[model samples]
Target: MSESVLKTLVIYTATLVIAVALASVLILIPAYVHYGEIHIPGSYNALYLSKYSPYKTIVVEIDYQPGMEPTPKTIEALQQQIEMYSGKEVLVYLDQDIEDDEVPAVIYGYDIIKITSMLQEQNRDYRTGWFGGNITLYILYLDTIWQQEDQDYSNRMHAASTKPYSVGVTYAADSIIIFKGSLPQNDMETTILLHELGHVWGFGHTNESSNIMNAEFEVYRNGPSPDDVVETWYPKDFSPAQKEELARLHETMHILALFN
Candidate 1:
């Protein structure tokens, strides 16, 4: 080939490669922005809960055994924390005087599968359908002597629904269980509650201690010591990434609801 022709071909090839790369990035950016690495379960295809509506509300029903109920202040703190992180209205109701007949069997060793199955059996009669623009969550506070093998009495056990149930069927309670004995200090109760609620909203344990979603309940921070200190911390709010994930889930649910 002539020298001039070769140079022209090389220039055209470079320009074409750059144009293709730019087009691919433009196509991927919107998907990344909207989804942000969230994976919705297949079962959620039929489930729809709106988190954006002005009337969107989450009703939390607290069923506590004798001497295991959370204090009014603690409940207030939980409500405020959830609202602050999610930007949604939360209504907490104390279901006083829960009888033994209504309480589920307590399983030991932090066995979430067993605990959730028992809750499903106990709350079989409860309705589980979308309430227009609102969502309902149940919480059980029990003093039934629950224990985790690795955790001490000071460490609370908190569990929530890990997956969505069938449409129009309430198989399990979307619940958080707080054992009274686990919460030794009144101040720490709110942090525990927030952590459990984070699970309900599809957040997993994070290594970052500064985040309330951390399973270890400690964050690393600079201190008077030369090295970074592993200080005990309780976040009053969710991390920005956590908040973004929750928002993405809500938006997905809202869009899915339209088709159902």
Candidate 2:
């Protein structure tokens, strides 16, 4: 080959090698972190913390939106579900048009601050994307999780990833789950609730249809299906290494629970 042609080929080969190396690193970093072969703190990994900390306690504030009537069954179901996150304590407040109550169903600016302070004071760990924190709900805002006229229903619905984790603290005050008004007859409310709850417990979406952690809302029962337990990161499934992490986290949760 001519000198120019040989130089061009070498340059292209070098670029290809560099690109492959970067791609390999991108893929391996997560695998290495997940496998316990290497632990990368703060790097995102599929292995998540269990919702219920044997050591720590979590408190939640469920505020309802005005004109949004969730049945007692729904509230009870949510309370029961959250209890799984530490098996110790969870507090739920329900009301409308209040300012900064522990749980304000409706949007009062003061209520937001109150809830935020509670989370901070309690030192809860929350997620960063849609799956973390108490869902900061704005009822009837029309900008949030509401259907628009002429919009495709499938496209408009809330998916797990649609709302990335805004905050990542799990606390007596941090995670805000907001209930918008006029829950549709369909399984929207239940699905969203369960999906968000899945996030709270450190479970990521999976391909299993029977699991609540699936990203899509094909099955929206009031609570977790039997399948959810199989993959949950509770004390039952912890490997030796994961068990250590659980012990440390739970011990911290227990300290917080004393104040609650």
Which candidate has the top score in TM-score?
A: 1
Please provide, for model 1 over 5-123, each residue's C-alpha lDDT reduced to its tens digit, 9 standing for 90 to 100: 99999999999999988865565433432232122222221121235433356666776676777887778877776565455677777765455655444444536446545654564
Worst 10 residues of 2 by lDDT: 135-144
Off by over 4 Å in 2: 1-57, 98-143, 146-173, 176-183, 186-188, 218-260
Q: Cα RMSD (Å) per model?
A: 13.9, 15.6
Compared with the true structure, model 2 gives a TM-score of: 0.37
Over 118-150, each residue of candidate 2 has an lDDT whose tens digit, in order, gives 533443333222222332211111112321123
Worst window of 10 by summed lDDT in candidate 1: 162-171
**Candidate achieving the largest lDDT:** 1
The reply for model 1, stretches above 4 Å from the true place, is 1-55, 84-89, 100-106, 109-126, 131-134, 148-173, 218-232, 250-260
Models 1 onward score TM values of 0.54, 0.37
* Residue 184, model 2: Cα distance from true site in angstroms: 3.5
lDDT of 2 at 167: 14
Give all candidates' CA lDDT scores: 0.52, 0.37
